[model samples]
Target: MSLDRHILSFLRALVSSRERKVATAGVVIGILYLLNWSQRKTSAKISLGHRSKKSNKGTVDLEFFKRIIELIKIVVPSWRSLEMFNLVLLSALLIARTLLSISISSVNGRIVKAIVTRDFNLFMKRIIQLAMFAIPASMVNSGLDYLNHKLAIQFRAKMAYYLNQKYLTGLIYYQMSNLDNRIANPDQRFTQDIDKWASCLSNLYSNITKPCLDIFLFSRKLSDLVGAEGPIFIIGWYFLSGIIIKFITPPFGLLTAQEQQNEGLYRACQSDLVNHSEEIAFYRGNDWEKRRINNTLDKIVKHINDILTKRFFMGTFDSMLVKYGATMTSYGVLGLPVFGPNREKYFARIGNDPSSITRDYIRNSSLLINLAKAIGRLVVSYKDLQSLAGYTTLIHEAKVVLEDLANGKYQRTMMEGAVYDQKSRGTYIIADYIKFENVPVVSPNGDLLIERLSFTIKPGMHTFIQGPNGCGKSSLFRILGELWPLFSGTVYKPPMEQLFYIPQRPYLPHGSLREQIIYPHSREQMEKLGYNDEYLENLMRIVRLEDIIEKRGGFEQVEDWNDTLSGGQKQKVAMCRLLYHKPKFAILDECTSAVSMDVEGSIYQHYKDNGITLITVSHRESLLKYHNHILKFDGEGGWNFYTILPDS
Candidate 1:
C-alpha cells in the first residue's frame, strides 16, 4: 500500500512541474509576440513619415541639403577670399577659447584644492592666474561676436548683389512682376528674407562649430579621468535621446517657411495701401483697404501662434530630457570614479587625501558637465537647422525663378478665354526703324489683343495711335519694349537705349531736378556725354519747368519728387527727360494729358524739332496737327492705318 501511495505522489508532482513549465513558455512567447507587433507598428510609422515628408513642399530632405551647399558657396565664395579668411580666423578663435576653457577648469580645481587644504598662498596664486586668463577669454568672446556679425553682413551683401544683378539685368524685373506668377513680393524676399537667411547662417556656423569642438575636447578629458566607458555611455545616451527627439520634433522647417510667406503677404498689403493711398482716399475705400490689410495680418498672426503653441510643448520635453535628465546622468557619471568598484584605483595616484579627491571630483565634474552641455547644444541646434532649411527653401526658390526668367522661361496664370501655346513664340528684330509684320499683340495672360497687326514708322514720321481702352494700345508698346512676349510674327524696333517711353503718370525718382531730366544717367554719365546741368536747365525751360528748379532748391537738392511735383509739373519733367535723352523714337502714351493744350502743343513741337519721332496714343484732336499718320484700333482684334491730310 505504501509503495502505491509513493508512486501516485511522484506522478502528481511530475504533472504539476510540467504544467508550470508549459505556462512559463506560453508567457515568454506572448511577450515576444507583443514586442514584434510594437516593432512593426513603429517601423510602419517611420515609413509613413518618410513618405509624407517627400510630398511636403517645405520638407528638409536631401534636396534641401543640396540647396544649402549651393547657397553656402555663394555666401563663402572662395577659400582665398576675405570671407574665408574671416572664417579661418574665427576658427582659430574658437580653438583658443576651447583651450582657455580647459585651462580655467584646471585652475578652478587647484583653487578648490587649495581652499580645502587651507593653503592661502596656492589659492591666491590660482586666483591670480584665473584673473589673468580672463582678459584673453573676454577678447575671444568679443571677437567671436564681432566676426559673426561681420560675416552676416558680408553674406547678405554678396547674396543681395547676386540677386540684384539678375533682377535688374535686361527687363527681368518687369517680366517677373507682369509675366510670371511663381514668386510673390520679391521686394520682401530681397529685404527681409535674405537678411534673416544670412544672419541665421552665420550664427549657425558658430553654434555648430563651437559645440562640436567642446564635445570632442571635453569628451577626451573625461575619458582620461573616468575611463572611456563614462564618456562613451553618456555620449551614447545623448545619441539615443537625439534620435527620439527627432521622431517627436514637428515639421518646424515647413512651418517657418509658411510663416515667412504670410509675413511677406502682410507687408505687401501695407505697401499697396501706401502706394495707392491717394486713389483709395479719393474713392473712400479706406474701410476696404483696412479689411484687406487686417486679413493678411490675421493670417500671419495665426501662423505664428501655431508655431508658438507647438514650441511650447516641444520646449517642455526638450528641457526635461536635455537639461534636467542630463543633470542626473552627469551626477551618475561623476560618482562612478569616486564611489564605484574601481574607486580605490582612482584615489591611488594622489593618496587618500580629501583635498586631492575633492579637487579631482571638481575637475572631472566640470569636464563632464561641459560634455553634456555640448551634446545638449548640438541637439538644440536641430531646430535652428530646420529654420535655416526654411530660409534656404525660400531663397533658393527665388534664385530658380530669377534664372528661369533670365532664360526666357515663364509661367503665368492665364486669364479665362485666353490662349497659350508653349511652342509658338514671336520674333524680335533690332533695327533703326519700327515695324510689325503680322505680329500678334498678346497680353501676358495670353489674351489675344490684336491677332495680326502690321504697322511701320521710320524716323521723322510722327504717328498717332487711337484706340478704346484695353484695345491693344499699351500692349503694342509692351511687345515693342519686350515687356510682353510675342506669340507669333515679327517685330522690328530700335535698341532699348534708342527707344524712350513716357506714360501719363511720370516716374519722378528720388533725386535733384537735374536727375529728373537725365534720369537713369548719373551726373558722371551726363558729364561723360558732354552735357551739364545748364543743358538740363535749357531742356526744363523748353518744358516750362525753369522757375520750378530754383523754387524747390538747386539742381543738387533731393526730395520725393513724385510727391512734391504737381500733375502738370510732373508731366513737364517727363517731357524734359525725353528731350534730354532725345532717343530716335518716343512712345508717348498720353504723356502730355496733364499739361494745358498750349504747353502740350509746345512740348510736341519741341520733340519734333529735336528730330525725335513720336508714336503717340491719345484722344486729343488738337495734337492731330503734330502727327502726319494715324493707326486706329477697333477694339476687336482689328486695326487700320491712314495718312493725315496736311490741312487736317
Candidate 2:
C-alpha cells in the first residue's frame, strides 16, 4: 500500500508539471522515430554488443587509466616552477566554485521565501544580497574556467615536448615505423589526439569533482529543511538513474577509438595520394584511388552512425529518467512538508502560520528541485564520460609506447649484437674509413637482405653499390648510418657528425631557399658555423642550379619549397645542401635519379673535387665512371666487392 501511494503521488506530480508532460512526449516521439529509422537502415546493427572484434580487443581497458596515472606523475613535474602552485590554485578555484554554487542555490531559496511570505522588505533585502553575491560568484566561475583551460594547454605542451624528445632520440622513430610498430598514425596521435585528450581530461576533472562536491554540500543543506528523507530519496534516485543509463549506454569508448583509428587510416591514405599524385595521374588510376578512399570513409561513417544511434537511445532514457523523473521524485519527497505525518512538526520548527508555512514549503521545494536538477545533469553526461575514457586510453597507450621506445625497452634485436668501435679519442679524431667486417644485413622483420659481406671504403674512395630492387643496396646504407641495426658482424664508419645521407626523394621542408640549403639548422647556426648562401650559390652554379635560384629572385625567399621546386630542381637543392654540410662521407642512395646524366655527373664530380668519400647506391650504369670501387649484390644474399677498372 505504501509503494502504491508513492507511485500514485509520482503520477500526480508528473500530471501537474506541464513542462514534464511536454518534454516526456517529445522524447518518446523522438525515440520512436529514431528506432523506426534505424530499423529501416541496413548499415548498423540494433544490438550495441555487435561491434568489431578488433575494436573490442584494441580498445583501451580500465588498466589504461592506471598507466596514465603513472605517466601523469612524470609529466606533471614538467610544469616546472608553477607545479605546486598550479595544483594549489586549481584546487582552491574548484572549491570556491562549489561553494558559490551552494550559495546561489541558497539565495534562490531565500528569494522564494521572501516572495511567498508577501514581505516586500525581506524580498528587497534578499535581492540585494543575491546581486552582491552574484558578482564574486560569476568572477570566481570565470577564473575557474580560465585556469582550467590554461592548465590543460600547459599539460599538452609538456606532454608533447616529452613525446617529441622520446620520438626523436637515437632513431627510435625510425625503428618504430620499421621494426616495432605497435600504433598506427603516430603522427596523428601526436598532432591531433593529444590535444583532444588534454581537453577531455581537463573537462572530466570538473565534471566529476564538482558533482561530487555539490552532492555533499547540497544534500547537507537539504537535510536541515526536509529532514533526511528528501536528500536520501534524491541521492538514491540519482544513483539508480546512473545505473540504468550505464546499462543502456553502448561501448562508446571502443567505438570512439575505432572511429579515431579509421580517421588516421583515411588521413594516411589521403597523404599517400597527395605524395604519389603524379604517378597515379600518369597511370590514370583515379577510379581505383577513389574506391580505396571511399572504403576507408565507409568505415568512418559506419562507426559515427552507430555512435549516434547509441546516443539517441541513451539520450532518450536519460531525458525521461533525469528531467521528468527528478521532478516527480522531488515533488513526492518535498510534498512531505505539506501532507506528510510530520507536517505539524515541520511547521512548528519554522514557527509559522499557514500562509507563512506555505511560503516556506515553496522555498524549500524549489531548493530541493534545484539540487536534484544539478545531480541529473551530472548523470546525463555519460556520453562525455565515455569520450574521456576513449581519449585517455589512446593517450595513455601512446605515451607508454613512446616512453618504452625512448627507454630502449622495445629495442630491435639487431642492435643487441652489433659493435661500435670508439678507438679514436678526443685529441685528433682520426677514424675516417668505412669498414664492413663480414656484415649481414636484415630487414626490420628479420628477413635476410645480405649475408656475410665484407668491404671497405678508404678515405677519398668513391664506391657504387648495385643490386636488383629489394636486394638490400639501400639497406646497406641504412645499416651504415645506424638507422637500421646490423643483423650480424660489425659496421665501422666515421662518427655520425662526419657522415651524411641523401635519399632518392629529397625532403624539402617548409622554409625559405636559404633554410632549405641549410636544413635541420637555422640561419643563425649557419652564421655561427661561418657558412652562408654566398658560397652556397657558387656550389649550386657547379650543379647548374644557380639559374633556378636566380630566377626565384634570391636565396632567402620563403615559400613551400616542396611545391615550388620540380623533382630535378629539388634534387639540385639537396645537392646544394649536401655541399653546404660537406661531411667526410656522403651516402647518395639514388639521390640524383631525377636529374639528367650530365647534371648528375657534374654533382658527382663536385663531390670528387671536394675529396668527399662517396658511397653511391644506384642502378645507373652511367654512374660507374664517377666511382672508384664497385660493390655488386647478386640478389641472393651474396655480394662481391672489386676495384673499378679505369676503363670500365
Candidate 3:
C-alpha cells in the first residue's frame, strides 16, 4: 500500500471502529428497550394538573411546562432562567438514555424469561423479530465493536510483545532489573493489563457506543413516538443534562490510571510470593516477604480509597438528574393544556360521562409518563459513560507500543525460509552478505549493557559464548536470536527461517511428544523440516528413547508430555527436537546444561556431524571442544573473541 493509503486505511479503520461501537451500544440498548417495553403495559393515567390559585379563578389546571419551570425554580434556582433549555435538553437525554436502558434490560429480561420458560419457539421468534431490528444496527455496532477491540488488542499485544521483545533485546532486561521501580510492577502491565485491556476492549467499545447508541437509537424510536419537535426539545434537555454532568466530573482519567497502576503494583507484590513460595520457604523469608507484600498492598489500597472518594463525588449528579426528572414532569403538566384546545384543557378534562376524548387524553398522559421514565434512564447512563471514558484512555496508551512492535521495521534477521525465486533475493537486504556490526543494546531510558559487541559468525560457522554469571550471555544470545533488537548496530542474516534460538530450559508445552517435537512449526512445515514419523522415530532412538516411545506411544498415541517425561528425558527430547529442525545455526543458551556431560557431548557431536552451525553458551569445561571459537564477555562492556584448538 502507498503511504497515503496506509495512513487512510488506519484512520478509516479507527473511524469504522468507533461507528461499530456506537452501533453495538445501540443494539444492546434496543434489545433492552424491546424486552422492557414488552413487559410494561401502559397503565391508565389520571390527568392530574397543577391548579392555579388566583384572585378570580378558583383552580386553573396549568400545563406540564409551567409546572416544570415552577418545580425547577423551586429545586434548582440556578436553572431557573434557563429552565426551558434545561428541561428541553436535559430531560430528553435523561429520558432517552433511561428508555434505552429499560429497553435493553427488558429485552434481556425477555430473553432470560424465554430461556427460563423454555419457550424456545417464542424466544426464537422474539429473537428473530428483534434481530431484524437489532442485527443490522448491531452488525454495524458489533462490526465497529470487533474492529475497535481488535485494534485495541492488536495495539496492546503489539506493545507488550514489543516491549517484552525489546526489553530482552539488547540486555535491556538486565538494565530493567536494576532500574528503580518507577513502574512499580511492569509484569502486571505486560501480562495482566495488556491481556485484560485486550480482552475487555470489546466491553469498553460497547460501553462507549452503547450509551451514545442508546441516545441515538432510543431517540430515533422515541422521536417516532414523540414527533420531530418533541425530539428537538428532548435533545435540548439531554444536552443540558450532559453539560451538568461534565461540570460535576473532574478529569478522573489520571486518577483511574494511577489506581490501575497501584492495583497492579499491589498484585505484583502478592504475585512475587506466589512465584517464589518455594524460595521464600527455602530461605525462610516468609515474614519478610509477607511484610514487604503487605506494605505494597497498603499503598495500593490507600490509592484505591482515594479514587473511590473521587468517584463518589462525581456520582452525586444522579441526585441532580432525579431532581430534573421531577421538573420535566412539571413541564409536561404545563405543556398538555397549552398544545391542545380548550376541550383538551384540564378544567374541562373530566366530564360527568366518560367519553372517547377522555380516553385519548388519558392515553396521551400515559405516553408522557413513559417518555418521562425513559428520560431518567438516559441521564443516569450518560453519567456512567463519562466514568468509563477514563478506562478507554488507558487502553489507548497500551495500543501505541503494540502497533510499533507488530509492524515496525524488520531488525537483525539471521534466517530465511526458501524463497523460490532468485529475483526476490536482493529485495529485503539493507547491506551486503549478512553481517553483525558493533551493536550496543539499551533500554528506552538509555541504560546500556554489553557495548562494542561486534561478531560475525557466517553460515556453518559454529561458535560458543562463554561468560560468568549475570555477564549478559543470555541477553547477547537473545540479541543474536532476533528476539531482542540491537540498540545501536545491526545484525544481518539471510531471513527468519534459517536460524533458531534454544534457551537453557527449553519450553515444553503441555502436549504429546510428537506435538512437543514440532512445537512452533506448523504440521505442514514440520514435514518440510524433515520431521515426519520415521525421521522422528529414528531421532527418538538416537536420543535413547526408542524403548520409551515403543512402550508408551508409537506416534499416533501419546500421553500428556509434562506428566510423562522426567527432567533428563525432557532435555534429551529437546536435543532430539533441535536435530529435527535442522536449522543452519542453532544458538543454544545453555540448553543442554541440565544433561550429563556424556549426553551433552553426544548432542554436540550430532551437531558436528550434521554440519549445523552451533552458537552455544555454557559454563561447562566439557563442551568447549565442539566449537571452533569462543566469544567471551568479561562482565564489563568488553568482549574477547578467540579461536580455540582442542589439540593445541
Task: Give TM per candidate.
Answer: 0.90, 0.85, 0.59
lDDT of 3 by residue, 1-648 (tens): 444575588678867787778867866985675454333211101111121121101111243224323322332345333333433343344334444444543454455556655778978976875565564445444454455555455545544655566555543444333322233455665676556444443344345444554546545653443344554665566567666665444334444555677687678677878867778899999889889878877877876775575556445445545455445643544344434234234345444323323433343344444444445555555434333343333433333333333443321222244212111111123332245576664432344556556676765566778777767776665555554545555766755566776776567776666777776666688887555788888888777776777777566665777557777777777888877777777878777777888878877888778877788887787777788778888887778877785411
Q: Which lDDT value does model 3 have at 372?
A: 48
lDDT of 1 at 499: 97
Cα-based lDDT for every prediction: 0.85, 0.75, 0.55
**Model 3 CA deviation exceeding 4 Å by range:** 1-242, 252-256, 262-281, 285-304, 307-316, 323-365, 406-451, 454-461, 487-494, 528-530, 547-564, 646-648
- Tens-digit per-residue lDDT, 1-648, candidate 2: 365697698778887888787978887996886566456333343343465433442333566567567657655774455644666686777778767766766677677778777889999999998899888888888887887787678768877888888888888788677755678688888878888777766776677666766677778877887778888998898889999776556667766777788899999999989989999999999999999999999989987887787677667668778887888888778777756767778768777566556555666675676577668868866666677677777777777777776654453444444333212111112367888887767665556666577887877678888888888887787777776655457667789878888888898887788888888888889899987677878878887888877778798788887888888989888888888888989989888889999888878888888878888888788988888788888898888888875421
Instruction: Give residue 307's lDDT in candidate 2 (0 to 100).
Output: 78
**Shift of residue 135 alpha carbon in model 3, Å:** 19
Query: Order of all candidates by lDDT, from best down to worst?
Result: 1, 2, 3
Predicted structure with the largest lDDT when compared to the true one: 1
Q: CA RMSD for every model? A: 8.7, 5.8, 20.7
